[model samples]
Target chain A: MSVAEKLIALDPLALRADFPILAERIHSKPLAYLDNAATAQKPQAVIDAVTEYYTHMNANVHRGVHQLSERATAAYEGAREKLARFVNAASPREVVFTRGTTEAINLVAQSFVRPKLKPGDEVLVSTMEHHSNIVPWQLVCEQTGAKLVAAPINERGELLLDEFEKLINERTRFIGIVHVSNALGTVNPVRKIIDMAHARGIAVLVDGAQAVPHARVDVQVLDADFYALSGHKMYAPTGIGALIAKAEHLEAMPPWQGGGEMIRMVRFDRSIWNDIPHKFEAGTPNIAGAAGLGAAIDYLEAVGMDRIAAYEAELLDWATRRLEQVAGLRIVGTARDKAGVISFMLDGVHPHDIGTIVDTHGVAIRTGHHCAMPVMEFFNVPATARASIAFYNTREDIERLAAALEDCRRMLA
Target chain B: MDLKDLYQDLIVDHNRRPRNFRRMPDANRVAEGFNPLCGDKLTLYLKLDGGTISDVSFEGSGCAISVASASLLTERLKGATVEEAEALFADMIPLLTGKLPENAPREHFRKLAALEGVKEYPSRVKCASLSWHTLEAALKNAGQPVTTE
Candidate 1:
């Protein structure tokens, strides 16, 4: 990347206009929707794509021989191709449609890892993973007598690479790590982690639910065995996400769910599974959601991920410096490499109270453990108010958030 | 809704210096409560003498609404009978949920009305009512933990 390219910033006004809900008023104040980590607001293109699907082609996919079925199937599978290309996958056959990242990780845990696990085997994850990443592995471990070990992290929320390398051993079978911490906004050194695991011939699953929207991900470059992501986090519809895996792993694993779409033939005594991607997709899939996701990928590509990543890095640097000026305010997760998230707490205020006070000024920030309870426990805070940035957010939105905090401290703290 | 309505002076005062903010060693009944949404927690302790409630206290951490609600309830219910406390808890529910009957007597919710502002923010109502729920749980069954969910 060139230095001039690094200095380029996206036009915030134009980007914000693409999202209709950004103009909404909360409590008669302009909505400063900063809760991007919870879920991102959709662009009009994605909304229109879903509406167009239901309006014109409302039919079950891959079932009927009629014209509508072909159109629906084309739209759905086209989304798979778009997503596969988005992550630079080897082929669309490796992409398996699931409800979201949770189901994607669970499919890999039960289908791929469960069959390979023996008693006393270990599946390693980091201390900063969302509950989605941790709980699925724990469920699989409980059934197979495998142990779940978490690699430690520092106060800065960066993963301890030395400690993580020490934990890898002959008994370790799999590694699940988050590409970015939702609670802390710390982007993990996943490339190094993947190389470490691959050196031991172990499969690694990267939880890309938080990473894909912020930056470009190339599965071939990282050589990750599996990558899971949520569409809603990437400006697509909810209940639509995908698991992109290596072809060897996908073909070798059995189907975790059994139903109509995943079957080649079902006899009374025996059943043959379908091909690589379809083998995991059970029952009728979310067709309209797939159309919306395809449109979301189109919108993101046209905007350019490099431009978004650079703009957000500048925005995060600005927010961190601005927030540090507030009295008695502490910013958690000061990783050297962070995305556009800033989790913070006031000296004497609880996060819930801070959340309420900010909402009165029409700033929407998430206040909770963010489904990363272990990270919160590590920091010794019950919760933190998180302001996650996206391409559409601007300086004015962040100003409203900081001002609301100042008022809250004066009134309560 | 205005921030002042929810975070009144009285609520902030009670939260700053919570009354009886310690575990009771001699209490015969205890119940722990958790509000998962906000990570607020409270443990209510009770001492019953014969058929009357002799003492009430709580120890925990929460937002201004929950802490104030618990402190105010302790002040109101320290000398009341167990049956009276249960009746008060039952009557206060409608007010907290913003469904109080038009002609209902004021005595049922007069002392607990500081928490009525929570009804405007439906999500925070769980925070304010969690302490009372724990009290009811402590009275009906002594040791089981409670969660607002």
Candidate 2:
């Protein structure tokens, strides 16, 4: 059967059973969670994995020789292997865990990019980047006296690829951009971006916080110098994320933090750092969180990323048509190739008001700047209400969201 | 619970053609508040006399809720003292948020009570409160200009 037919035949209510939180109500109504872009709800398997780790094998990893300690270390390292396989990283050593994407970007900015960037060097980021992507580059530029340049996007939220190429030159040291825009769901052409930057001997960092959850991402295929993702965005718990880098880049980066797990040997006089991933991971890691992330990856693999992507794409196409039928409703990001995120604003109605009225019928969505202020500015809107979907979201959910939005329009009008 | 209770004819009328919805030429405090999360932005100007809000006007951009709420706040505080205005602003928290507050001074928020429609929209509570937050900041910096994030 075709993916759309499979999705149509699939009962999302049954799929919702996998997520215990989906059963709960928001504002005394069924929680119609359409805010997958912000953070996906965790499944029972991921929750169980985390709980089981804390219950049975809670101990500091790589430090102790006891049974629980060894088990904990194995589980932690096992998660690393799972992540390495998930993103097609060269080795587990290249996968360094941080708090989330923000910290990962900060790590790259401080350790990798900052030292290399000179006063006149330029770092090119896109207009559609999240504040996380924009702010770090700004910080690095501020610290190093380097210049931060923005590559503009077209009206449809597509990056102006030619303009992006123009931004790259001998003065351009690095190009950092979001693989998929969190606000507009504009899936960036990162392979071309990487190739363009690479030809000019410029490093590239792809913020994959949005893409990794919906799409099958092979960082190796992209050949990106640094790729970062948040585990929470992929149905895992918050506070755990990964940064995959080439082993050489990992080795070259100065240690981001100084503490227990990251240090090889410590003294008052001098200290040597651990190798690769350990060199970046400073504190006692979020071992249970990592285990949860592993479980999330396992769940996705079981479902199959290709199947999930196809199902979600069908949903996006369906939702796009459905939402367009609503009078006064205008979709913000109309990129030719995009993900399941639908950001829209109803004429004469505030997005927050729309969000509230929709929730009365138990339809949940995100309403805000989406942390991409520049994208909002590009659209000349203060904010928009966004509905992002996952594989589990059904056509019925879209109908309900549409119906709720219509009801909201009438009630407000 | 219905929008009718919050977006009353009077509030709607004011939102449609807000009174004193212009910049104050001789204003004591002018401030802007922006809720970056939701893209709500507002600029407020308050003319004070000793400790009382003598005249107030505003000009900015935001959603209807913010624009309406700012209109309501301006009308309610025209003749109110600083303490009374502050107390009224404090009393509006639960009404605008649609949350039942323990020991809420709901009686004191008579005119501002029109914003009860905002409760239905949890996300927009920030929009409705944007003007009040700016007012609070403007009140504190009554003699000097202020702004808020």
Candidate 3:
């Protein structure tokens, strides 16, 4: 069988066993965790890797010459290299460790875009970007006197490519796009977006926080100027993520922060900055998180990203079809391409009520604006109850969600 | 933690057809309450007469708990003196936060006690108390938005 068929045929229940938390019982019911878009449950391998790091190689990286520090440094740098390969970046140097995708975007906004922008210059973004992608640009625009322009999305939540192309003009300096919308699960045509931006001599930053967990991202293949992702959303620990950017941009951009390890030689008069990745990493990093993220990359690689993507596609399709059967239920984003996210609303039932009622059945889903309030405004909803799937989720989980939703409808009605 | 406790018939009824859910064109005091966590928002309008709430209403969108609590607040506040409303606020804050004294008399709360089950869900406490906080802002005549952080 081909790899796609092999992955599609894999026993999801067996894969579920790899995540120890999947066995947890909530309110005397088996846990049905469908909130992967918020953060994924870590596998045992990632947990062990984090535990092993603290247990054995618990030392500061890149500074100490001691044996523990050397081991720690090697492990941490090895993680950067692994992530570099995982995203198919040109070099590990292009991957700068960050607190998470939010911080990575903030860094790019402050260092790369802020200085280059002039008054009245426009930073283009989609209507479906998460707040992390929107707010930093707004802040930078506030400081630089630039304007943040939003490219509209269609009623189906897909980007209006023609309108987006129209929004890009001489005044547009940067384009920030979400690879997969956290609220809508719309897998944006990022490669096409990048090509369009590059043709106009504009830079593009892709928020891969929601995409990296669901699909393989090749920064080189996309020719993206900068890409950001959160490790926590990909079955790794929190407080660790990366920004992979082109070498030229990294070199051209001034360091966002000034602190130890990021500086090469400091003086009362002037300070020399460190290299590309290290210059951006200002403080003692999340060493344990890096180790866990490394193991997460390894775990994903072992299972194969292609397989995970294919399997999640199946799950997304199944969930879409299953959720459509419910009366008065509206699926928010019906983009031709999507990730493993389903944001829906039951008529006359508030999302918060849906969330609470569903939790009675031990079905965990996210119910809120999902940090994408603009998208909610576009859909004219205060919030949505989102059940985002992962590789370990089964059709049984979808059934549980549908049943819990029905219970919510019945109770609310 | 029981869903039944949280979503009582009273709450559902109030949420479905909230009492006093309209703009008061002749309002003396107005305050906006926003719960950023869930995007719940409410604009409270009150017409005070000689330290008494002569008329009160609210218009906004929020979860069931929020809308119900706001609806219930409006129903209880009408004809109540500012002092009595303030006292009720003092009593209601502790009750919703699960800090009510065990020996505290329940009769003072009356119908508003329907929201007591919200204490079981710590995250829902803000949803239940958002309007109360907004009411406090309106009573103080605070000209800024209130947030249930």
Each model's lDDT: 0.91, 0.86, 0.93
Candidates sorted by DockQ, best first: 1, 3, 2
Q: Give the better candidate number (1 or 2) by DockQ.
A: 1
Clashes of 3: 0
lDDT of 1 by residue, A1-413 (tens): 32233235446777777799999999998899999999999999999999999988889988999988889999999999999999999999989999999999999999999999999999999999999999999999999999999999999999999999999999999999999899999998899999999999999999999999999999999899999999999999999999999999999999999999999999999999999899999999999999999999998888888888988999999999998888979999999999978999898888999999999999999998999999999998888999999988888888888899999899888
Candidate 1, residues B9-80: lDDT per residue as tens digits?
878888888887788899988999998777898999999997687988999888878898999888888889
Name every residue pair that clashes in candidate 3: none
lDDT of 2 by residue, B7-120 (tens): 577766666677779988899888878777666667788999998889988887666677888888888889789999888777677677767666755777776777787686
Model 2, range A1-413, lDDT digits (tens) per residue? 33234435665565677899988886677777899999999999999999999999999999999999999998899999999999999999999999899999999999999999889999999999999999999999999899999999998999999998988878998889899898998999999999998887888999999999998999999999999999999999999999999999998889988888898899999999898899998888999999999999988887778878887898899999999999889999999999979999987777877876787678889888899888888899988999999877888888889888887677555
Q: Which pairs, if any, clash in model 2? A: none
| Deviating ranges (above 4 Å) for candidate 2 | A1-13, B1-13, B26-29, B46-55, B79-108, B116-125, B136-149
Worst 10 residues of 3 chain A by lDDT: A1-10
**A10-67, model 3: which lDDT tens digit per residue?**
9777777789999999898999999999999999999999999989999999898999
Ranking by lDDT: 3, 1, 2
Winning candidate number (DockQ): 1
User: What does DockQ give for each predicted structure?
Assistant: 0.74, 0.55, 0.73
Q: Each candidate's TM vs. the true structure?
A: 0.97, 0.92, 0.97
